[model samples]
Target chain A: MQVQAASSSRSAQLPPNDPPGGTHRRAPEKLPRSRRRLAPYGFLLPFLIFFLAIFLVPIGYAIYISFFSTHVSGLGLGPSQTTTAFAGFSNYRQAITNPSFYQGVERVLGFGIVQVPVMLIFATILALVLDSTAARLQRFFRLAFFLPYAIPGVIAAILWSFLYLPGVSPVAGILHSLHFGTVNFLGSHSILWSIANIVTWEYTGFNMLIIYAGLQAIPQSLYEAARLDGASDFQIALRVKLPMIGSSIILTTVFSIIGTLQLFSEPEILRAVTTNISTSYTPNLLAYTAAFSENNTNLAAAIAVLLALGTFILSFGFLRLVQRRSMGVSL
Target chain B: MTLTTPKTPRPPTSEPKPVRYDAKGNRKQRWDRRSVLTTAVLFVVTVYFISPAYWLLISSSKGPSTLYNSAGFWFAKFQFGKNISGLFSYDGGIFSRWLLNTVLYAGVGAILATLLAAAAGYALAKYEFKGREAIFWTILSGVLVPGTALALPLYLLMSKVHLTNTYWSVLIPSIVSPFGVYLARIYATGSIPTEIIEAGRVDGASEFRIFRTISLRIMSPALVTIFLFQFVAIWNNFFLPLVMLSNQKLYPVTLGLYSWDNQYGQAPQLISYVVTGALVSVIPLVIAFLSLQRFWRSGLTAGSIRI
Candidate 1:
């Protein structure tokens, strides 16, 4: 209400800058009152348009289609006989019950539980080490650590697939040259972890940069104060630096969780090297298989919805947990 | 007009402290063990991180016959030129087409995404309007909604409009980056002062003109940062194109290489193409990252510091 009054009064009090000859620059205040009020909206319209088409509408459509399933009658020989009908909660039920979908979810949950912490730990360690006064060549190390992130995830998977291939693997060849026996990285038992290794390699450096940024943001005065207090460098990093960057740590953690749930490219590409990864090895892979290969769009939509909800819930739950533990730390 | 400022004021001590050495011209000796351990750990981890890429660099120079039988870490035969020709000439130069499509998608998509994001983010930062917070939060929620989750439904919607199996399917969705808006808003608030904007307003410049003429110039640094990020993102993006484009001509290099890698059973030689193509694809982005390290590092902190 106040804004409306302000805009109206501004319009009323506007100087009559419009020249009779129309040779001067006109003031924006001379524009219509409604356009003035809607100016911000005008700027936002392009982004909002695509945001609606891509984010909101798709989410709404996913929910809409999830509740519907296709039906076929009379042996389903003709397109006319097949129809999509509202399935109530049946698609959700199927998604929940299907061991394939849930198991894929389980696999990714396990992947996140193991991968996120280990990756973050590695990132935190690297960041702390680089931030340390003792570390030399900080810029060079940072670049090397971060270079893998520039490699696209699928490409990283392919690159690693070569290392995992028994024939071409230098790592395995070295292992074989040693007294230890040959190791099968693509074995069903280790394929998930092999994928995990790829994820860790691809993301650890990216996460390190975030944590490192947080480390950088810590005011140098804090370190000076800690030094004046006779705190050792290790103590300072552990006590001062770690506590200050709680929010960045949480930010990376949340993102990693989300990325973990969206694990499609690595395992999908790895399918080229090994048959161990099934079409439903991950929830996302499962959804793609359902939609494109199985021709079950409703099931795919339901699984996608479930995956999204799981991501939100897990990340939100983690945030809440950290916030409660930290008590006033915001992320 | 008197309020114009070219850059954000530099905060005190943002740079890391200069290394301190003792009278002997070595790192402080009191913590020699810690220093040695830090250096050793960093070196080892750097090696761990770099060895794969180093191997890739080495392998990209070798011939297909030498890939498996030879020392994986050491070069056997210098086949770099042959491999390049083979990579480009394979499947009637489809690899070049994929690279072009990738450039087209990522280049156009990132530019549009950055512009829209900057505009919306600027308005959010500079203006007061009803439901402003609501709109901002709605967009923020878009960040949490995973892209893979949206792929199926987005594909369905595109197909409904008979727009699937085309570049538009990938490009349209690629332009909606919620994270870009989030970054832009943070950047604008930090860098572009409102007084300069008001000065423009008093000069009778339209708001859009002020944005274009003054604000964009001020925000160019952030704009470049956003463009690089969104470009790398769209280039790295795999699943969207995987879901949207069936025609190989529309495939990004990532997807195109994946197709070749997937078909290794039928064509063993494609492995060489995939390896060489992988190396070729990453070179430009790797150089970009190394060159723009300062920009992205600052951008990351700017976007994440508040959180």
Candidate 2:
């Protein structure tokens, strides 16, 4: 089977050189030109159908709903009495002006700024270590590092929640034993950091794997060349390896930034244990609160649209900035 | 990422070739001080990474009261079996039901997604069609748009169609992975030679048949990579289901556990159940990750380097 597969693949690779088969010539002539041209579309049909239904349609609906609001008259108790009206940019304005939404945005920005770099640095370090010459048990360590990533985010949050709980946390127990006054990870001031910790723990290894893969792609000749120039391992890593994996680092950063904006599960799960996290703790959470808790679907739709736009801008903007910087450096 | 590169026809084979200094370099500087330092630092980081999971394992095996009273790290009374039984029997076996629901969502959804993505990616990779770039860009944009941002809109849209509480709500959305499509396209382009598809065509094989028999067989490793990605993604998904599903029966394990953890204040015993359930929920994924590490690692490399 393997031989047949391999030989067929080789034949497939040399199609232009091969003489046209008698049956194939007849088959194409029998099929309409348009139908032949449409074969790719036929292949793409399934993905496009789901993509339209699940992605494009919802985005369209969100944009449509973002422009309208239901105005309730009198007691506002009945769906019949509440009439939908065009609100133009009012919903967007409201979303922009809402203090909670801004707070959520600020919080996410803060989280991303600090957390992304820390996580990426850790990931870079781990990736470097794993890719190092002297690294022992590389497979075991790689798996161990990436094991948390295999665990679902919610489960990671739950597991870490137990670790963060005062009486339940082993770290906290050790801290208490050392006579450090009880530290509250779930406290309002620390909860964001706590959430950052969970996010970091869940994602660092996955990012490490990406960076490590990038490291793997680096030519050994480059390392030998650097070593020949009397560069230490650290110098080689900092100058050559780090610069080489710049795109991967940027990619991981962009992903981490986008992920930070979508921070819901950790905060949402943490909300159960602590009063620090409100329903509107993050933009996504705020949008959820508006849609479900407040029953303001229009406002929620506006928030979602705005958030999506923000995400697109931020992600693309970062990409563009990195591209320009790299170009500038190269030039 | 663009699907322009068609080089590197076999990625898995490229792995061992890159390690040019694996034996010679290692033996030259075996147990050097720098190597020892690097090893020490990595060991510390690995310990930090594993500690919480280690804590979860030990903590879950403790009795409810002992969880709070005992040293969080130590195995205080082996209640692993007891916890498992308690977790299974909890709330009329709701935990088991949640696990099944998760499997249904992640497993089936991933399989269907892999197939769809494979098809789409193969099309994008192999075909020269009008508006292909436009379609690719549109889907690429979908990759950047965070799913959390879409959850509200999807909820509203699903409710408009009266499918909000149904399995289709989660299942439908979970399968439309733009990244999967992106990866598939890259993999198809990199690994599967277009000449083969042309050869299959010249052999009077239908395009679908060519894909099924020739392209798919060659693309199996990449497809597994795509499947594992989509599987882990759908498995880890929390917000989409949390919004679409209020019905406990339809809740994925993540959402189900969150809801239970919310009520932990009222019934503290639920804490142990949550821990045990969290541990249980992670087992399948751990197994999957370990088993498919090669495919996933290659997939990651393919995604990064190709881009």
Candidate 3:
């Protein structure tokens, strides 16, 4: 996405008046030279402060804590008996070897494999349909589709959990009225997919809007040219529209991967209703359980760092693969 | 439009004139079978997206006994008012407190985040400085790091400073949105012309004054976009507040409802209150989204379209 932004900015050539040395010309003005030099940093000061405090500091602290663990002496009941000592990779080793952590990681991996593709495909289809000229009441349908995104994820989860419950769910109610066997949506086997459904419900419209915006940016002339060459609307959509918005699709997929890996809210909310979802059902959840529930902040820090590393690797690896494929196509 | 007209004149050897004209007319103004099918499909999709909320609306209106006895889709007894009153008065109006806390976090966090993003983005776009690209890339990388991944570390850090279980733990982190900065940069670059800034400089306007007086006016649309994005984001956020606040009083509506949901098994009567509370919680956001639809749409477009 940043690469795309960079290329786009380049294509949108900088105005000549806004040269690199443009600030130098302002020396003749009333503004002093030193203040002029410091002005950009001044504008950026608040964000930089917040960025360092909130983003960089936490990650750094996590890394710092990941290297240390508390050494408990006899009885270990007082502050003097406990001391923090460097454990090096022992915390990471423990986090890596934990069966529950692996289970959580595998669960998220499986969830992403199924959920991301399904969600992105649904979003792309919705976007293509909405971008079609034949689609009526575009504004109304767009808002309707997007309205779910306005609802908080926790609320969306709560609402869906109700709908999945046998007594409250219209779906369950209909099935029961039809004399069908009761299907527990929150059953152990179905809970992951139920969480997927909730996430899909929350995010599909948001992704659809991204792809639709990409489609809207495609010039009308491209469609005209395709039509002139005897392409049907379906064919035009498959060949032209899909390929043109490839980067946007990739962008959404990368985002979906990151989001899927951090699956916490939906499952956490659903955990209230059923025991099917364990505290360590997702990697983030496992980290949380470790830090707060188990009072093992070092292990939790290591798990959090590992999760962040995993996300970075997957996202960048996907981008690299896409870059190679697109490069091949251009060549 | 003119370009498409010429394509219709060519007669396809495979198809008859009527079918060709029908297809061409469908592409133009005429409503044909395809448009009908398209509308039908979209309508079904719309219903699929909206039915859960629809169910919530009607289900909340049913009384506790009728809620379990009657069908979930239809209204049993118009008990929405009673349910709402119950939801509010339950536990001494904790739900209202949660709502107020959510507004305080999301509203103030979003506003401050938007202002900071606008300033940083304007600097990156309109000004030339050393390490500008480096700063931009750092922030962009921050966007890729999921908030959930930072929850534990942030909790530890906040606890170290004795800031955990407080509003600042949530609001401070919420106010640093890298994505908002990215959006603002893209928006400012596209919307604010360099010549305007140059003209301001020539007229002896200070850099900060020019930004305040001129650039801000032109960047209003983008600023609104940033505000809405951050607002929705901060509101939807869960892991941060969940990790930070352990006190029931500090809970946002999301966390508060989750806690109530946890207790619903022991007190089945609280189910109606949860339903009503969910309904009430979403109403403000739905209203905001509907009213500010245009700004958000434009924001989405500007944020997505790389060029």
Candidate 4:
């Protein structure tokens, strides 16, 4: 408002420049201000367009789709005999009751139960090792650890999927050579572990990088002071480093949790390699199967919506809980 | 970053103080032993991480028929080229097409993502507008929403718009990265100064021109950082492509290899192909990492100082 009046009054009192200068600058200078305000919207327009058309619309569509179900009339071949309509809670009810979905959750939970801790522990140890004094070629080791993370999940899964095969696996080859025999790495009982290992191998370096960043942020003077107090290196680490880097730990942990829930690539690839992983191995895999194989897009949408809600409740609630425990510290 | 070392005071001290280190030769020897042990542990840790990748590199050169005959960790007769060529020739060179498709999906998509994120971030950082922070926060909130959770909805929308089965399905959603935006904003806030803009305005440079000539040059390093991150991310992405695509022709290397891997029982030769494919997939990523690693030093120092 102030800008508008100042420009207009200044233009009214304008001292026009020489004859060759055909234009006054004050009014036009203000013209750019109004446009500059609109500039942000212009900058945001692309993201907004894609966001609404893709993200916003789809979420709304998921909600609407979740409430609908197909009505297949008797003699269901005819176009008139089949239709989709509202079916409140039915799809959700089905998903919850389905033993396959339950099994997937249990399997993944079991996978997480075993895997996440091992990953965190390995990452923490690797981070600590990298941070340790007298550790030679720190950058070299950092690169070595982080190198695997650069491999795409699909590529990593493919690489590991082959190694799990009995006929082609070098593990099997070596075992046979040593007469130690071979174990089915991707068999039903072991497929969970196989997938877990793939995930760990692909992501441990990533988590280590984050954890090491947190480790490197620790103040050197604190460590020196702790040493002056006659504390052992181990004691200083346990008593000082861990507690100070707590927020970063929470950050990595939450990211890992989300990654675990979204587990797809490794298991999906392993599915082709092993008979053990059925179509409904994970909620995501289940949704994919329902949509593609079963031709139940509505059910797939329903599961997706429910899964999204589950993710929000779990991820946000867990993070919030951590935030509260940390007395308002955020990741 | 703080490392917990015992009280080894380094400051120039004028006052005489009782020092434990004068009589602590045993402790010094113990510390040396501890350092050796730590190096051994680090070596072991490095080996553990490299085992599988090393195993893949060694196996890729082996003939399919001899894969089971060869030991796990040793190289066989050099057949890397043969395996790669066999992979291409097997099934009408679909593997090569998949590799190309992956390059397209990750490369193009990541470039677009980096640009959009930088633009959005730069605007958010430099501009003072109505609801500026609201928009930034909205984008930041997306950081919590996992890509897998969003994949199905995005797939459904694309199919509804008849955009599915096209490159748009995989590429469109890859461009909106909350993390990239977050990083860009931080980088912009720290690196770009308000005085540069005021000076540009004083010189009669247009705002957009100022952004182009002055701001982008200053933000160049941040742009590269975001690009590298998004490149790695999209390259590694699997869930979105999986949910959005079904046509094998459209499959990225990850999906393509998976399909081939599934058929290992029918054709054991694909094992060699898959191994070679894995080795090929990692080369570009390693190169990108090494080239961009120097940029990460600034990022690390930024981490320590929180500036």
TM-score of chain A of each: 0.91, 0.89, 0.87, 0.85
For model 3, name the residue pairs that clash.
none
In candidate 3, stretches whose alpha carbon ends up further than 4 angstroms from where it belongs are A1-32, A74-80, A176-180, A327-331, B1-29
Tens-digit lDDT track of model 1 for A174-278: 999995798999999899999999999998998998888778777677877788899998999899999987878888988898899999998998887789999
Error of 2 at A5 (Å): 26
How far off is residue B247 in model 3, in Å?
A: 2.8
Ranking by TM-score: 1, 2, 3, 4
Q: Go through the candidates in order and give each one's C-alpha lDDT.
A: 0.84, 0.82, 0.81, 0.72
Candidate that scores best on lDDT? 1
Model 4 chain A poorest ten-residue lDDT run: A18-27
Residue-level lDDT of model 4, residues B1-307, one tens digit each, is: 2211112333423211123223333342244766787778777878867878898778889988776676677877888889888977888888888889888888888888877877787788777778988887777767766676577777777777898877888888878777777767767777777778655644446667877798878777767767777777787787777777878889888877767766778887887888788888778777778555545434433332221
Give the per-residue Cα lDDT of candidate 2 at A320.
81
Could you give candidate 4's fraction of true interface contacts?
0.46
The digit string of per-residue lDDT tens for model 2 on B1-307 reads 3222323455532433324556345453367787788778788888888999888888889888898889888988788898899899988999989989999999999999999999999888877778888999899899888898788888877887899899999998988889989888878878787677656765767778888999888777778888998898898789889889989999998899889888877887788888888888887778878666766667777776544
Write the residue-wise lDDT of candidate 4 on A1-331 in tens digits: 3334543553454434431234423333445557667766776677667666656677788778878888677774555566888898898888889898888777777777789889988888787766655355566777788877877788777777767888767666767779886778977888888888888987888778767767766667677788889997678778877777666567667677777777777777777767888989988788888888997878888777767776667767877887788663644
- The best candidate in terms of DockQ: 1
Q: In candidate 3, what are the lDDT values of residues A225-280, reduced to their tens digit?
A: 89999998899999999988886788788889889888888988888778999999
lDDT for model 2 comes to: 0.82
Q: By the lDDT metric, which is better: model 1 or model 3?
A: 1
Among all windows of 10 consecutive residues in model 2 chain A, the one with the lowest summed lDDT is A24-33
Q: Could you tell me the lDDT of residue A2 within candidate 2?
A: 33
